[model samples]
Each structure stands twice: as C-alpha cells, then as structure tokens.
Target: MGGFLSFVKKETLHIVRDRRTMMIALLMPVVQILLFGFALSTEINNIDFAVTSPNRTEAVRRQVERIAANPYFTFKGYIAPNEIDNALRSGRADAVAVFADDYDRQTAATERGEPAEKAVQLIFDASNPNNAAAGAGYMQSILLAGRQTGAAAPETRLLYNPQMKSAYNFVPGIMGLIFILICAMLTSVSIVREEETGTMEVLLVSPVRPIRIIFAKMIPYFLLSCLNLVSILLLARFVLGMPMSGSLAGLVGISLLYLMLALALGLLISTLANNQVTAMLISGMLLMLPIIMLSGMVFPIENMPGILQGVSCIIPARWYIEAVRKLMIEGVPFADVLREVLILAAMTAVLIGVALRKFNDKLE
Candidate 1:
C-alpha cells in the first residue's frame, strides 16, 4: 500500500514538473470553449446584393428598398443590367434582383383581377450553394409578404450549388478534420518521440540521409491517413447517407494532395518541437483548434469578422474543405477546383522545403 502511494505521489510530482503537459492541461478547456463559443454559428446574414431595374418604376424602387431594408442583405445599389453578371463573377454580389420593364404593369394587372406574370427575377451566385439557396429563400419570403394582392412571385434561378444540403457542407469539413488531425498530430508526435528517447541521434549518425529518414518515417502514416480518408468517405456515404455527386477520381486526387500538405505541416511541427509532449500540444492547440474554428469547418467564413476571415485565408484546411465541398457536393469539374489544388500544392512544397532546410541545419 505504501509503495503504491509513493508511486502515485512521484508520478503526480513528475506531471507537475512537466510545464508543457501542465500548460496544455490547464489551457485546453479554456481555449476550446472560447473558440467554439465564438466561432460556431449557422445563422447567415449580411449577404451582398445587387439590384437592376430596366424601367426603375415605383414598384421596382419599393421592392429594392424592401430587400435592402432586410437585416440579412447589404444592398450595393443599382447596377446596369449588363453589369449584373460581372458583379456576381467578380464576387461583388452574392445575388442580383432584376426587375423587367413590365414589372409595374404586371403588378397593376394582378390588382385589377386579371392573371399577370410578374417580371421580378432573383439570380443567385451558386458558388456557395448553401448560402445562395438560403438567401434566395429569405428573399422569396419577403417578396411573398409584399404581395398584398395576388401577384406572381419572383422567379428564382440557382447557378452552382443547387441542392444546398447541410451534409455537403459537413462532409468536406470532416475530411479536413481527419487529414489535418491524423497527419499533423500523429507525425509530429512520432518523430518527436524518437528525439526524446535519444534514438534520433543514433539514426542521424547512420548513412541514411535525414530527408530520406523523415520520408521513410512518414510514408507509413501517409498510407494510414489515406485509409482513414477512405473509411470516412464510406461512413459518410453509407451511414450518413450523404451522396458523392462528383467524380470519384477527382475527389481522391485532391484528397491525396491535401493529405500531403498535412503531412508536410506535421514535419514542420516536428522540426520545431524538442519532445513529444511539446509536439502534441502544438498540434492539438495550434493546429487542430484553428482547423476546427477558423477553417470554415464549423463556421461559415463569410459570417466571421473580416479579420478572422482574413486569418482563415492562410489555413490550408480552409482551401481543401472548400475544394472538397465544391467537388463532392456541387459536382464541379477539376477545373473548378484548380485554384484550391494549386494553393495546397504550393503550400506543401513550401512546408517540405522549409522542414528539410531546418532538418539539415540541425544535422550540421
């Protein structure tokens, strides 16, 4: 009994002495609560909107004013009918309200107990299909309310994300979470463990090049991460009943690219850490938390503060998640996700180059 008690006391003291572990234990809950509390929200607001009227009649003016007055929309004022497409393509507008010259005439006809077709058109930038669908729905509700008489509702046209399923948003986010957590945390801890046990010094003395050694260690984990990716996709499909609407080959290729980026990031973390505990803390607190909170995994980047949205730009998970959503949910071709693929590729190259440079410096 006394021996057992002494062992417990000694272990407790050791834990107390380990500042990295102690700090992680103390700070983790606080950090998670603050991040999740502040960042997680589904409520969409402040949607950018453009208005175009062929005749600019009182009815058109009233409809525009009503839409602009809504809390969800930020009206960018009237643009030329020709400029509406450019505005959406340039990301200057999320939705466009186009009123035909016959809008007032149609409304008058409806009021006079006659069948009339309303010429109000609502066109959405379906790039983020979820937001586009939701915004369009809200606008439709508003238009319906404004129709005191039996007037025809506005015609809605969706561009890209037509289904607007919540699953489409979450599946890609889950992929980002799995890849980053598995690749970065696991690799960082695995490499740092050897350093703590003094085995890294022995390996460094061997004929094997340090870069090669790093790659050899990472290859198995990379394969394991791939397996995990497949498992996740299976579960998402069969269990969650989510549809994979995109090309399977494209999804796999992009996922592999993201996996490499994550692995490279893990190697970067390992290079900075002196021990496994530090690596774990850095991966969990710095990498995992941001991936969840700032990477558009749990929160919409558009709803975030401008500064936080800017911060999300640097998170590789953000790009990958967006790419996967576009591909898998929207069934977009590889050409559509080209920018995301290129960004991940560039980031992977930079991280690998930097990690190798640092490893060589350490070897010297």
Candidate 2:
C-alpha cells in the first residue's frame, strides 16, 4: 500500500510536468463538448416554402397571405400549378401548397360532412426529416388556427420525441463516450511513451515499486479527466439546456467507474505495446473506433443491423454511454445503472490484472 501511494505520487508529478499530456486530458474534452453541443443541431427554423394557389380567389389569396405571415415559415414565391412539380424536383422548394378551384367549396362541404370536388394538395420534398417535420408542424399550426377550430383532435398520437429536442437525445451519450476516449485513450499513449523512452526503466530500477509507479502515473490524469467530465456535464446542462433529470452524484459515481476502466485500458495498452507510437495506434484503432461506432453516440443501437447490435455488446463505450445517458438525461437511479457499473468494474479489473502481469514480465 505504501509503495502504491508513493508510485501514485510520482506518476502524478510526471504527468503534471508533461505539457502535452496535460493538454490532451484537459483541453480536448472542452473543445469537443462545445463543438458537438453548439455546432451540430437538428433543430429546424426559417424553412423555405413555395405556394401555387391557382384558385387566385380572394379567400384563397387571404389564406396564402396568412401562411406567409407566419414567422415559423418563409414563403419564397408562387409557382404555376404545373411548375410546382418542377420546383420541387429541382429542390427549389421544400413544400408547395396548391389551392384547387373547389378549395372554397370544399371548406363549406367539409363542415356538412360531404366530400368536396377538389382539395388543397400540399406537395413537399420528403427527403430531409428535419425539414419535413418543421414544414408539417408549421402547416398544421396554420390549418388548425385558421380552419380546424371545431375539428376533433387526432387520436392515437405517436410522439416524434417526447422532448422533441436534439440535445435531449444526443448530448448525454456524446459526453460519456468522448470523456472515455479523451481520458483513457489519450492518457494510455502518454504513459506508454515514457516506458518506451527508458525513463520508465530508470524509475523502476530506482526505489519505486511497480504499484507505486502505476498509481503516480494515474492520479493526475484521473483528476484532470474528472474536470473534463464536469465541463461536459456543465455544457450539456447550463449551456445547451439539456435537462439533468437524475442525481448528479449518481452520474459522478458512474463516471468514476468508467474513467477507471479507461485508465486501466490505457495501462494495459502501454504494457503490451513496444513503443508510444504503437500504443497510440493500438488504442485509437482497436479501442476508440469500437467505442465511437458501437456506443450509440451518433446512431441508435436499436436501429443497428443484427450483427452490429451483437457487436455493440462488447464495447465498453456503449455501456458507459448508456449508463451516463440514463443517469443524466432520463434521470435513471443508481440502482438502474448498477448492472452497467458492475460490467465496467469487471472489465477494469480484468484489464488491470493483465496490465499488472505484463508490467511484471517487462520488469523481469
């Protein structure tokens, strides 16, 4: 225990002295958090729309004018009935609201339960989901306020998202996986680099035991990584306004477990690799790719192909992402995260054991 504490102290000192490691552990998370939180958003606003109201009657014109006045929509111009297809095909319009001659008659007949001769056809480019959702929402609001005041509300609602915000789904997972990558993968290479440089040899030959050396190397990075985690959480909540519906303590606890897993993975990589460059290549390709691809950070795991979903089961990042998202976004209790936490702990223990055995072999 004394040797471990002394080695931890030495490792912390070494990390603090190394400027590059400091930058990676501290700066990368802040930059990634800000970029993903602010720069990438699926929220739609000021969508372009075109109308081809050929009826040209006073009533039809007035309704078109009302829709144009809505802030949620921006009308480009009118097109001929035939040109509506050309405009939509050429990507000149997201939607074209066309009023047939019987539109006015249809309005009156719809109240009396009789189908009219012609209907208002809203032709839209259904390619972009965000644009389509925004267009549909704006059109529905316009029709509801202007025409459907007494109409019965549609039943059997299927919510697009209960929260309907991009961050509500994305930020939590991004934060978790990014933290793991920055802290674990980045730190792993730095420590392994020292071993390859003969500097680690000098320390091991001195009074330092293997356990102390590992602990010293880890403590500073562990603290710095924790700071990075805090920054991500703050950005998600205070800046992006993503709700932290669960206990902060629960999140921090789970985060610590994940960090340990990352640190252990780093230690394991450093132990096995011949040099710093090899450590980085191995960590980035073998660990980082699996984490980012399978972790549900950018894509839904449920939507993945059967083989990919099965592959996701082995990804530590996937478990970490799910655990942190549930804790922070959905407000899942610590008990709910317990199974994931246990899995992470088990993985960490296994990696640490392997790393220790490898380190001992190197020393011999």
Candidate 3:
C-alpha cells in the first residue's frame, strides 16, 4: 500500500511539475467550451426578407407589419416583382414574399369556408438549404398567425428543445471532443516522453511490476481528466444554461468509460510511436480529424454519403456524442443508451488489452 501510494504521488508530482501538460489538460477544455458555445451555432436569425404587394391595400399593409414584427426576420422594404431575382442574387434579401392583388379577398374567402386561390408566393434563395428551409417555415408561421380565424390552422409544437438553441446540440459534442483529445493525446505524449528521455528503462528495472508502473503513470492523468469532465458539465449547466435532465450518475459512468477508452488508445499510440513528436502527430493529425469530421459533431450522420456513414461506425466519439445527446437533451433512461454503453465498454476492454500486451512486449 505504501509503495502504491508513493508511486501515485510521484506520478502526480511529475504531472504538476510539467507546465505545458498542465495547460493542455486544464486550459484547453475551457477555451474549447467558450469557442464552441459562442461562435458555433445552427439556429437561423435576423434574415433579410423582402415583400411586394401589387394593390397595397390596408390588409396587405397589416400583413407586412406582422411579418416585420417577427424576431427572426428583418424587413428589407418592398421590391418590384422584376427586382425579386436581383434581390436574392445580390444577397439583398434571403427571401421575397409577393402578395397577390386579391390577397385580401382570397383570405376572406378562405375564412368563409370558400375555396380560394393561394394568396401569397414566397420565393427563397435555396443556396443555403438549412437557412432557406427555416426561413420558409418562419414565413409560413407568420402567415398562419396573421389569419383572422384560428379554426382551420395547424398547431405546431417543438419537443426536447422548443427554442432550437444550437448550444443544446453543441455542448455534448464539445464534451466528447475535449475528453478524447486531452486524454489520448496527453497520455500518448507523456508515455513517449519517458521513452525519449531513457527514463522508461529505469522504471522497467525498478522493483515495481510493469503493469503496476503503467497504472502509476496512468493514475494522475485519469484523475485530471475526471476533473476536466466535471468542469465541463458545470459550465454546460450553469454558464451555458444547458440543464441535465437525466440521471447524473448515468452521465458520470458513461463519461468514465469513454475516458478509459481514450487513455487506452493513447497508450496504444505511445507503444507504436518512437518519440513524443510522433505520438503527438498521430494523436492530433489522425484522431482529431476523424473525431471532428465523422463523429456527427458538426454534421448529421444520416445526411452523409452511405460510404461515409459506414466509415463513421468505427469512430468512438460518434457513440459518445449520441449517448450524451440522448441523456442530456432528450432525458432518456439508461436503458435507451445501453447500446452506446456496451460499445464503449467493449472498446475500452479491447484497447486496454491490446495496449497492455504491447507494453509488456516492449518491456521484454
């Protein structure tokens, strides 16, 4: 017990003495949270909308006023029908709404249960499909609200995230990204550094067993990564206004499994790499890109090409992100995320087994 405690203390002191490693493990997560929280967003707002009315009746003016009052849209003044194309082409407007001359009559007819021609024509610039789709939906809502009678209107309700805040989606993804990068990259580099400095041989020759030495090396990083995870969760809940609706214990358990997988992956890299620089390169260049691109962090996996979707299956971050989204945002039960949990557990076991075998072979 005394020897184990001394080894843990030695590893802890070594980590604390290294300023660069400390900054990467501590400061990087905070910076990434701030960057992703503020800058990265998918919610559409402040769209430039142009309107044209041929007759300019009081009813048309009233409808226009309602459209301008919407928070999502900024009215860009009325445009001529001929200028509609130019408005969209020049980026002067994201969409154009042309009211028919008989808009008032058509609306009144519809209210009286009479069949009427469509009262409005909405032309949108589909250059950005997401923005176009959201803008069109917003316009439709405005039109429906402007109607005098509510009897025939369809009621829409958004679940899970009613306001459609992008942070709700990004926070979990950023959590996965930070954990994987920090644990894997830092562990790999730390292990490789000992090899480069000829210290690994001294440790191997010590009274401690090889497996015990490896655990001693890993203990400090595991604790540090746990601290980082707690810090991220606090920021997400208190600072970013994202609430955890699921079981806290479940989240912690899943996160710990993911961290273990990351650490083992790093150990594997360290065994394969000849030096700290090579380990860093492999962790950053190889792992980071796949985590970001194929993990469904920024893009929906369903929207990707079939081949890319198949390729994304092997990326561990994908499962972690999906599990977090289900637990944190959707408030699903542990049973719902059992598949993700099993996959992560399997990954951790495989990585740890392979890494241990390689480390023992290297020692021999």
Candidate 3 positional error at 288, Å: 2.0
The lDDT per prediction is 0.77, 0.76, 0.88
In angstroms, how far off is 263's CA in candidate 1? 1.1
**If scored against the real structure, what TM-score would every candidate get?**
0.59, 0.85, 0.91
Question: Could you give candidate 1's per-residue lDDT for residues 252-275 as a string of tens digits?
Answer: 999999888888888889988998
Q: 15-94, model 3: which lDDT tens digit per residue?
A: 89988879877988877787777776777888999998899999889888998998899999999999999999999999
| Models ranked on TM-score | 3, 2, 1
The Cα error of candidate 3 at residue 61, in Å, is 2.8
lDDT score, residue 9, model 3?
Answer: 96
RMSD to true structure for each model, in Å: 12.8, 3.3, 2.3
TM-score of 3: 0.91
The regions of model 1 sitting more than 4 angstroms off are: 1-151, 154-164
Q: Which scores higher on lDDT, 1 or 3?
A: 3
lDDT of 2 at 258: 82
Candidate 2 lDDT over residue span 115-230, tens digit each: 66655777778888768867787686676567653747553443433545676667666666666666666667767777767787787787767667776777777887788878
